[model samples]
Target: MKTFLLFCWLPLTAQAACPTLLNQQLPGLMGGTVDLCQYADRPVLVVNTASHCGYTPQFTKLEALYKRYRDRGFVIVGVPSNDFHQELERNSDIGKFCLANYGVSFPMATKAHVVGPDAIPLYRQLITVSGDAPRWNFHKYLIAPGGTTVTSYGTRTEPDDPKLIGQIEDYLNGMPAPAPSVPPPAPPRLKAISGS
Candidate 1:
């Protein structure tokens, strides 16, 4: 009985020690903390965004998808980046534009460097574990309910694209529903840009 109890406790103990997504908390434009761990048990769709990039329009689809599945235990997180020379001049300004233009109500993190040497620690871990990095704006990471990165999609993957949506639905409706309130930690802040 002792050994069985120890075995059961082992995995729980390890999870407590594991670095969770909520540890890196980032402030959202709405003045709230964006903690990935809050949505820990839910499937997350992470996207690197840019305001001026051609893919910027994807925000519309992204938001639509969020509304469609958010109640079903799926979330879409947007991380603004200037790595492609396409983001707004300021992090706050990026928020403003996203709100004014895209009507984006989903959570968004502060602007951060997503590539190169100064990339945020979260992105670094993402790259290391997935063997891929944000190649361009709109690159997506699909995280399973268990906090493991399940898959990655390229820039061409639209937010409502069938392939992507199907996977999310599968995970959301799978055996045990994912935890919906745990969010990951915030990524490191990047150099702030001046609003244009």
Candidate 2:
């Protein structure tokens, strides 16, 4: 009985190391699944994206941002969403467009809803804790290491915005704000294109 109990407890203890919010495996944009726990203890930026939205071009800046900081325990996970009616119809196309147009080499998840009751579990937790749903494509959420803190950025926020970079640096340097639950005010956003 002691041996059986010890074996059962071992897996539970290992699972406790990763936060529940990041314990999921999102389907990869290219293929297979992206085990979110692989990024545990690292600063992760999650973005809701679209292939045809005005903010689509932000992919360029996002890619550059990822390349600049990825070596220092930073990662960006692009999530193609159609909630705003702008994403391509298929995952393969999304993979190709991002690579061919923006040269995106960062991690990208397969298409997933980012708003409302049907949102993926990660987005659901993000919205619940951050109190801000994505208003349009390219909505960003910065998850601090250990997943204890999350900062929500609206569509207007640029990928290379200084404040966002500062926050990322804070996470990388292990110096997050005293209270970062609420993000700073967002800049004016462009009107979203409907039925694009």
Candidate 3:
């Protein structure tokens, strides 16, 4: 009876360990779905990206970061977004660009909405929990192991930023995440124009 009870409880524990924010399967960049839950136990950097954006060059640095820390339980997920009118229309083109130009091996999601009400379920929850949204392509959200905590970095925060690296290392080493950085200013809301 004790063995039976232990077996029943183990699955529940595993399920509960995965963060709700990470319990999503995004359309994979190449094909199929990229299961976020698979990275729940590691420190994963989720960045909203665009193939033609000015910050696109950051992908090179990002790939470097992934190569450096991936062996230590770190992952980086690129979420291509066209909300800013910069991403390629086809996932295949996007994937090819990433591979040919930057050699990005980390997981990447197909084009997604990273802003406003149309944002994907994962991005929506990330916005609500962190009170920050991708203001532009390359905006990043650093989620600690198990999503126990999250920190936001704006588009300009380079992948090699010391503070960003420090936070990642902290998570990998089981250290507490650093305090939230000063968030970017909220975007201006458009007033409804009443017409006669």
Q: Top model by TM-score, which number?
A: 2
lDDT at residue 129 of model 1 (Cα atoms): 71
TM-score (all chains, Cα) for each model: 0.78, 0.83, 0.82
Q: Which residues of candidate 2, in runs, are more than 4 Å off?
A: 1-11, 175-196
Better of 2 and 3 by TM-score: 2
Model 3: per-residue Cα lDDT over 108-165, one tens digit each: 9999898888999989988888899888899889998878688999999999999999
Badly placed stretches (over 4 Å) of model 1 are 1-22, 175-196
For every model in order, what is the number of clashing pairs?
21, 0, 0
Candidate 1 has what TM-score? 0.78
The residue pairs in collision within model 2 are: none
Relative to the true structure, candidate 2 reaches a TM of 0.83
Model 2 Cα lDDT, one tens digit per residue, 80-156: 99998998999999999999999999899999999988899999998998999999999999998998889999989
Q: What is the lDDT of residue 92 in candidate 3?
A: 97
What TM-score does structure 3 among the candidates reach?
0.82
